[model samples]
Target: MAITHFTSSNSFQGYHITQQFDFCSGFGQFIDEDGNPASFSMAKERAMQQMLRAVPTEANAIIGFRVEHSIGSYVHSDYNNCILTNLITCVLVSGTPVRMEKDMEQKMEKVLLVMDYPPALPIRPYLVTLIPGQNESTLVQLRFFSYTSEPISALQADIVLRTVFGEDIVLPDIGFARIRAQDGEHQTGFFRVNLSDSLFSAQSASVRIKKYVCGSALREGDVHNQRIDMRLEDLFDLKRLYGNDAVAPHVVYEGGWQCLCGAQNPTDEKTCPYCQRGGESRQVAHASLLRQAEELHSACEILACLQAYEAEHKGSLPLTFMEGLEKMASTERMFGNMKKECMKFLHEHLEAEEAAAPADVPDLSEEDQAAMGSDAEIPILTPNPTGDGDTAAPETEEDRFTIKSPFDDPYWK
Candidate 1:
């Protein structure tokens, strides 16, 4: 007879077991006639039949095998399987996360006004108050004396007043800065500064407000090292929008399936491979959904950028969905091309290895070695010298390919 016991740590793919129960009656307890103790084989068969009947007729469910065991006897000398029955369950799960993020990105597609420094500096943490027509037209007060001892020169100090305020105005006084060029050329992308002793030395500086330009500023949340505490409902809401069906309704928190899926789980389960839908084989659909969600998220980012630009520039608008998708397609194509180029390099490397596998070294005689060592004897020029007067020098051919650093030799100096 086939063994009735089964132990699988994880849910097998393609099956679904929603619930299970184990019923064991104590010895000498059951007096009901209909619930009489049956033989082990009969009890096991009946248990199997029960599971078979539980399988959903309308939809698929895991009904692999059901075993009934006799733990102890009930009102009898011998143990009976019917009175001490144990039940096991299994199920299949499926889903993908494609539609959720797309909806979210679209919903939150708003322009964000911000400010940025050229050399990516930490947030100044202090606020600056400025006046347009009064008090030297503009004032910037630092929280404390800067590390640089000398008052930062107008050439070195740059202040970019950003607000997503105006896209067309060529900002004056605030757009010039000492921009160090990588290739020995100077540039002024934006912002020129005028530091004042009153603004710098005073505990605080306040000035009349005037016209200002604006740009995007990184937020506290944008900081790389900051910890994030996100709510599960929000995560699930996002997932649901993106069509993440694999997101389990019942999150197993403490024991199993503990991976975070943008959702907070209070408990966990050892094997959550079963869903209302089915098992592991269906997980591929969910993987594809995740990919879709990522794409949608990126699309949202582009939309946000457009909105930011529009906010800064009046009469502007965000790109159409199709236009954004075209850009995305182009980006994907470029990425694909880059991947192919990388693969080509790997292939070339393998080919080079194969070609070099049987490489041979040419034997050099003593004379050849001596000739290679002494370069002073070798002629720098023959009769056909390009320079002005040079007597015909001995022309001894030597390998000039021997590696040497140009800086290593003092002759160049």
Candidate 2:
């Protein structure tokens, strides 16, 4: 008799056992060499014991056992027609055997978020009050509003005063405030601004409010940063109070596309130097949404970028920013450009969504509306290289396909 056992990759050991017995008569008890009774049950017990002894002592337990039995009969001429019988049995056991003490060492690793979601809040300089005191300084009041539904436990901002004439003034650090979600619309606080008459007379001035909101319950760590620029004249009735003829300067808020590394790049830049992300209007709009979702930064900036893109693209909005990123990643053009942090943040926060329909409703003339209903080719006008009002016809297929070498050009010659 022969027995074999196969061990799994995780198994500590393998065991095999085989036993054989000979009998002259069928269905009769026989005596062993020690005069003990020999039976199939006894032979099975001996096979099991041998298999158990062969197993390593460090093995936890045995599992997945199989047993096989075979019987043969042969005629012996010397036995005068008596038939001799031989019986063989085999048992096999296979399983993954593991030590309980070593199980902790084989544990799988876990991934964790490096940065927490930023809090949402809007802050601005709301009012200015003249304090009755020996000093001529005025009290500047700032209002804070909760951007999200949750109550804002704490908030702060870095205030910088800049004059329209390009003079930068350093301001005191603003303190924190506890603001309720419902009461945020009416909340206001004061900061003292000491301004000399000469400083006030010089052109218009603006306040740059760099607001920071504490993280919500799901996120923890540093405050979320957002920049807001407001004109001092708009916040207060300076003409009525100060009799200063300073007009408010045209306020151009800093807004642009966000890079993969979360850096804000100018709209004119074609590529981001930090992460090498595309700086086109579509790419910038998508990156801005990612910054808003991940870092809770650039909400207003992102809205501006999206609005500009929509206005430029015939009132058509791109796909949902996250969905657009996914579609772009599926193509070879944008493959591997997305960072792991950005992908992880998107996976944990954003839900699958369909593209939004364009919101703009254009007013078209009767002839234009009729053209839309027909399959007639529309005339597209191209701009001339010169600043003149001459309109050039759209390029034909031949014009587009035709290429000229640099040497053939008049300028090159």
Candidate 3:
């Protein structure tokens, strides 16, 4: 996990010359237990193996490598059900490529693995409010943990809810716990229980955790139990324990200047002079096209276009805005100005929507609000053009335009 004798000093001439390079590869299908296409975690070990190969054979070590991964999903109709399958996983790795001194010794130390018991209860409770009506409902989220020293093969639990009025609601067989043994981490699962209006009116509720099974045996025989009183005031204080900061940013599209046929037209030009697609229809078409463009371009292509632009313009934008846009369009299939405009449009749209909503409707918590305002945007997914369930490598033309030697490039030197 640690690298010794590796310094990031740009003036270190004694060491081998270093240049940055991009490496991309694909691995694994995104299939769930039920054969549905779902996003799944790519094992760390498998990802590491792919990254190791990214370093050239001539290089002694890889330093300051950063990785970005994305899963592409493809949907198709099958037997009246829409089936989603993992199209491909794109792994993009970038780092300072270098050769180490022959005499320098490198060593890796052994580390001990530690295992511990999982938490018995949720770190905190989450409250969700249903619509205000006769069949009004409320969701109470619960987190369960494992009792065994070893990682549990599977776990299941039943929860019994008793109201102050002596009414009992039993929920059985609630958890799916199949954590890996080598992971050495206890299983933590979340289960949500829906309570009707009558249940929510109860003065107090008791939760009994029963039939606690782990790894083929009952770990706890009705031992874990908790009781909580439902408050009328707290009903209005719905809060999400986890924030949406991790969610991808929404990408917006703006249309006016660029034409459908890739022609550079002024904003005043309401219609694309070449394609004849213009006005409101053109704007909608342009947004869809931009999303398609975003999907077609890979990270490598964007990085290449960015590097090429910087190299030619002395770290400044091109003399003609459209010229720089053209370069980006060639690689990324979209221009920087377009993306910026799209972001601005998205912001205004969200603000307008929020302003128009009725005040009585409860707003998301502060954390959730902040996450929505964050600058980060999610990666746009596009249909795979290859149709082979593999991400195509960056075109050779991109590689040809890049600086080949570190000594010649000011950034690398």
The lDDT for every candidate, in the order shown, is 0.28, 0.35, 0.36
TM-scores for all predictions: 0.14, 0.23, 0.19
Clashing pairs in 3: 249-378
Tens digit per residue, CA lDDT, model 2, 1-413: 12233233323233222221221111222223333334445655655565655555554443344444343333234447655443333323223322332222221111111111122323322222222212554443333323333444433444444444677554545443423223223222334456554333223223333444434443322345433222332312221221111112111136655432334557676564433435443333433444344433333333444456556765344356534544534542445444444444343333222123232233559987786676643222121222121112233686433322212323223
Residue by residue across 143-249, what tens digits does model 3's lDDT show? 22222333343334444444457776665655433222211222222233445455443332233444333435656544443222223222211111001100111
TM-score of 2: 0.23
Compared with the true structure, what per-residue lDDT tens digits does model 1 show for residues 174-261? 3222221111112222221343322222222111112111122212212222111323333333233322222322223343332222
Every candidate's CA RMSD: 32.6, 28.5, 34.4
Model 3 regions more than 4 Å off: 1-141, 145-147, 162-167, 172-195, 202-205, 213-220, 223-413
What value of lDDT does candidate 1 attain over all alpha carbons? 0.28
* Selected candidate, larger TM-score, 2 vs 3: 2
Counted clashes in each candidate structure? 48, 0, 1
Off by over 4 Å in 2: 1-134, 144-149, 176-187, 198-413
lDDT of 3: 0.36
